[model samples]
Target chain A: MKVHLFIPCLVDQFTPQVGIACLKLLRATGHEVVIPTNQTCCGQPAFNSGFREEAREVAYHFKTIFHDAKIIVGPSGSCISMLKNHYRELGLIFPESVQVFEIVDFLSQYGQSLRFHSSPQRIGIHDACHALRELKLYDQPRELLKRIPGLDLVELNDGQACCGFGGTFSVKMAELSQDMAREKVKTIQAADVDTVVSLDGGCLMNIQSTAEGMGVTLHAKHVVEVLADAMISTGEQA
Target chain B: MEFTPRSIKANFTESLKDFTLRKNLTKATHHTIEKRDALKAAAPDWNKWRDAAAASRRESLLHLDRYLAQFENQFTALGGEVVHATTIEDARSKILDIIKAENGRTVVKAKSMVTEELELATFLNAQDIETWETDLGEFIIQLAGEHPSHITAPAIHKNRQQIAQLLHEKMGVPYTEDPELLTGYARQFLRQKYLDADVGISGGNFIIAETGQVILVENEANIRLSTVLPRIHIAVTGVEKVVPSQQDYANLMRLLPASATGQKMAGYVSALTPGVSGGPERMIVILLDAGRRQMLASEKWEMLACIRCGACLNVCPIFNRGGGHAYGSVYPGPMGSILTPGLSEPGNAPDHAFASSLCGACVDICPVKIPLTKLLLQTRGDVVNTHHKSWDNLAERSVWKSWSLMMRHPGIFRIMRWFGARIPVRFHWGSDARKLPRLAKETFLQQVRDGRFD
Candidate 1:
C-alpha cells in the first residue's frame, strides 16, 4: 500500500530527522511512501492565532496539495488536528474521501506488523497536549511502543500536563508559558529517564528549549525515531 | 483589597514568583484532580452522563426565554418574587433595596460567584449591614480581605497554615494548622452571624423551570442555613442556570457534585421553592443578566452551560502555575478565561481570552461538555477581530501574515524556511525560556529529492 506523507512545516524545516524517521519506519513496514513536496503547513498557527483569512488561505493551499491523496499522515497531531477538525470550523468543506491521521494513530494499525530487534533503552513519553486530548490518542502510540524488545517506556509525571508551547502563546504569555515549560522540565529531571519522546514538534521544541536553559540533559525524539531505531527490517527477520 | 493596580499578566508573573503560593496551588489542584479522576474511573456511564448533561444545558439555552418565563411564573405562584438585574451595579442595588426595605441590618451570605461579581457584601457593608461569608472557604478568603481566587474552592491558593494565620490575625483566635480545628473556629464564629442576621443571601446552582424549585448543592451545608435562618432571603444567580425540567436537573445531578467535590452527592442537595415554610418569610431571586443575553446571541452561548465546578482549574497547567487571582476577575481558569470577557462586556478582561495554551483538559472533564477550548479560541478571535485590535502583538500578527503568505505558496516557503529561524527575535516572546530552533542542514523534502530513505 502507498502512504502519502504530509510533513508539517515545523517538522519539515526544524526537525527534518523526525520526518525522515517516519519515512524509514513506514518503508520498513513494507509500505511505499510519497512525500508531497509542495505542501507547506496545515495552517495551525494562523487558525490558532485567530487570523482566519490567513489560516484559510494556507489551509486551501494545503488542501489543494493533498486533495487527491486518499490517505494523509503527519508526524504532528496539532497540525493534523488542524487539517482534520479546524478546516470545517473555518467554514470550508474537507473532501469526504480524504482520510487524515496523526502518524502514531496511523502506526497503531500498521505497527503490529513491524518486527523488533534487541536493544537496551529507557525513555519517557511527552504525550503532547493535542495528541493526548484533541485526538484522544491514549493507547495507540504506547501499544505500538510496547512492541519493541529491550525498550523500557516511562511516562511523564503528569502526562496530561502541557509543555506550554502554545504556538504564539509561548511568546504572548511568555512568562507563564515558560514557567509551565520549566515545571514540565523539572518533572522530567526528577524522573528516572533523560529522554522524552512525543509525536508533537511544538512540545518537543519547547520542552527541549526549556531544558537547555535549566542545564538539564534531555534527549527529545519523535515516537517514530525510537520505534524505527528498535524495529528490524521485515526481510532481515525473514 | 487593592488588587495592586497590576494587569492580569503582571499579577500572574508576580504569583509565579511566590514559591509558597505555587506550592499551595500545586498541592491543592493535584488533590482535586486525583479525587475527580478516581470517581471518573469508577463511573462506567461517565461519557453518557456528560452527553445527557450537555443536551440538557443546550435544551435550556435553546429556549432560555421560555424556560426562564416558566421559572418566574412557577416561582411566583409559590409566593416568590424574581427581579432581573441589567448590570452588576443593578444587581447589587436591587439586593440592597430588598434588604433595606425590610429594615435588615445584618446579612449572612453563602458562597456565590454572582455575589462576588456584584460585590454584594462590600455594598451591604457600606450601607452599615454587617455581612459574613458562611461557607468555610469563603470565610477564609473574606478574613484575608480578598475576593475568591477560585470559584468553587474560594481559598484554593492558601494552605492550612495560611488559613490558620489569617484566622488568628483577623479573628484573634489562636493559630492551629489542623484542618478540623480551623473549621471549628470558622463554624463557631459564623453560627452567631447566621442566627442574628436579618437576611440570608445564597447563590443558586440550578433553577428548575418545571416546578419553580431552586437546587443548590454543597458539601458544607452553609447554603442550606444561609437560606432558612434569616427572616428575608435573597438568592443571586445568573440568568443561565435554568434547567428545562426536574429530570434534566436529576441527570445533571450526576455530573455537578461528582465533578465539583468528587462525591456521588454533596453533604446537602437542597431543593426548595422559595417562600416555603421553615425558609425565609420573604424570598427574592435576583436573575442577574450582566451580558448573558449578549452571550446567548454570540457563539459563546455554550459557556453558560458551565456548572462552575472548578474542575477545569484543577486540571489546567496554566491555572496550576499562575493560580486564579491572575485573571483579575471573579471567575478564573478556563471557563473564567471566557466568562470574564465574553460576559458582561466582551472587552472587560482583555488579557483573559488568550491566556490559555488551548489545552482541552477542561473540555474533557466538563460535565456539560462546554467546548471550553473552542470557545476560548473564538474568544481570542473576538479579541483580535472584534473587541480589541490593539491587544495582540502587531509584530506577531505580521509574522503570521508573512508566514501564511509563504505557506500559501510552497515556492516562497522553500526560500523562507532557510532564513525564518535566523530572524532571531521571531514573533516577540523569544526570550531564553522560549527559544526558536535553528534550521536543519537539509529540509525533509530536500532529503526526499536526494533519494534518501530509498
Candidate 2:
C-alpha cells in the first residue's frame, strides 16, 4: 500500500519525532510511505479561528499536494478530523481530493498483519477531545492497543476530557486553560501509570508540559511510539 | 444583569478552587449522566422516541398558526383567555392589565424563565406589586437577590453554607446547613406567599394543543400549589413550547426529566386544562413570541427544538467552571449560549458564543440531539460575519494572499518552513510565563530525506 504522510504544521515545526514514529511504524508494518514536500499545514488553525479564506488557501494547497495518494494518513487526530469532516466544505471552492485517514484508523485497518510483542507495563490512555468527540476514534486506538500482547490498559478517570490545549486557546485564555490543564494532570496522576499515551501530539504535549511543571512522574507518549516499542521488542525476541 | 462574566469569573475562581464545588459539580454531573444513560438503555427504542419527539416538534412548528388558533379556541371555550403579545412591552402591559383588573397586589411565581426573560418580577416590583418565587431553589435565589444558576437545580452554584448565610441574613431564619431543614424553612416562607398572593404565574414545560393543557414538571409540588391556590392562574410560555398532541407531550415526558435530573420521572407532572375542578377563577395563557418566531424563521431554527432539559448545561466544560451567571442571561450553558444571541440583539450577547470549548459533549448528551455545538458554531459564524465582517475580510484576504503565494511555489514553502523551524523558542505568541516547545531545526520532509521516514 502507498501511504502519503500528512505532517500537520504543528508536528512539522514542534514535534517531528511523532511524524518520524508514525513513518517507522507504518514502514515496519510493511507499507511504502511518501511525504509530500509541498504540505505546509492543514489550515485548521485559520479555519477554526474563523478565517475561511486563509483556510481555503491551505485546503487548496493540501489538495494539490496529495491528490494522487492512495492512502493519506496524519498523526494528529484533530487535523485528520479537519480533513475528513471539513474537506468537503473546503473543497467547495477547491474541489480536487476526497480521501484522508487518521493514523490510528489506518493502523487499525491493517493491524492484523503487523505482529508485535508487548512489555508488561500498564498503559494509560488519554482520549483527545477532537478524536473522541469529532472523529469517533476512541475505540479504534484502544482496539489497536489491545492487539499488542502482554500490555495492561488502565482507564483513567475523565480520560476522555479535553487537555485544555485548543491551539491559540491556550495562550489566549491562559488562566482558564491552566486551570483546566491542572485538573486533567491531576486525573492523569491518579491513574498511577508509568506511561500515558494519546493519539494527538498536541494533547500529549499539553499533558506532558503540565505534568513536568507539576513534578509528576508519569511520562506521556503517542500511541505510535508505544506500538513501535512493542514491534521493536518483537524483533528482538525473534 | 445580575453578575457580569468578569465578576462571575472572579467568584468562580475563588469558589471553584475550593474542594467542595469541584466535588459537588463532578458528582452531580456524573450521576445525572449515568442516570440518563441508564434510562436511555432501558428504553428499548430510545432513538425512535427521540425521532418521534423531534418529528412532533417539527409538525407543531409547521402548523404553528393553525395550532395557535386551535389552542385559543379551545382555551376560550373552557373560559380561559388567551393573549397574543408581539413584544416584551406588550406582554408586560397585558400582564399588568390583568393584575390591575384582578386588583392583585402579591404574585407568587413557580420558576418561570419566560417571566425572567420578560423581566416580569422586576416590572411588577417597580409597580409596587410584591412578587414571591415559590420554588425552593428560586426562593433561596430570590432572597439572595441573585439569578438562578442552573435551570432545574436553580441554586446549583450555592453550597449549604452560602444558603444558610443567605437564609439567616435575608429571611430572618436560623442558619442551618442541612438541605432538608433549609428546604423546610423555604417551604414555610413560600407557603404563606402562595396562600396570600391573588395571582400565580408559572412557565409551561409543554402546552398540549389537543387538550389545551399547560403541563408543568417539577420535583417539588410548588407549581401545582401556585397554580391551584391563586384566584387567577397565568401560564406564560414561549410560542415554541406548543406540541401537536398529548402523545407528543408523552414523548417529551420520556426525555425531559431523565435528561434534566436523571430521574425516571419527576415528582410531579401537572397538566392544567382551561377550567380546573376547584382551581383559579380566571385562567390566562400568555403565548409569548418575544423572539422565538424570528429565531425559527432564521438560520438557527434548530434552537427551537430545545426542550429546556438542560442536559447540555450539566455536560458543558465552560459552564461547569464559569458557573451560570457568566452567561448574563435568563438561560445559561450551551442552550443559553446559542439561544441568547438569537433571542436578543447579537451585540448585547457578545461574549456568549466564545464561552464554549467546542467539545460537543452537550450535543452528545442532548436527548433530542439538537446539535448544540453545530448551532453554536453557526451562531459564531453569524456573529463574525455580521459584526466583524470587514475586519475578518481584510485579515482573511491578507493571510490568504500570502498563503496562495507560498502554496503556488513549493520552494518558497520549504524556505518558510526552514525559517519557522529555526525560530528561537523565546519567539512565542501569547503570555511570557508559558514557553513554546522548542522547534526542530529540520522540517519533517528534510528529516525524511535523511532516512527518518524509512
Best by DockQ: 1
lDDT of 1 by residue, B43-115 (tens): 9999998899999999999999999999999999999999999998898888888888999999999988888
lDDT of candidate 2 over A97-190, digit per residue (tens): 4457788888888756776775788989998887887788888989988988899998989787777777655654555566777788888778
- The lDDT for every candidate, in the order shown, is 0.84, 0.78
Docking level for model 1: medium
RMSD of every candidate to native, in Å, equals 2.3, 3.2
Once fitted onto the true fold, the runs of candidate 2 whose alpha carbons sit more than 4 angstroms away are A88-97, A232-238, B2-24, B389-413, B425-434, B449-454
DockQ of candidate 2 compared with the true complex: 0.42
Who wins the TM-score comparison?
Answer: 1
Model 2, residue B437: distance off in Å is: 1.0
**Candidate 2 lDDT score at position B398:** 73
- The collision pairs in model 2 are none
Off by over 4 Å in 1: A234-238, B1-6, B387-394, B420-429, B451-454
True contacts kept of 1: 0.74
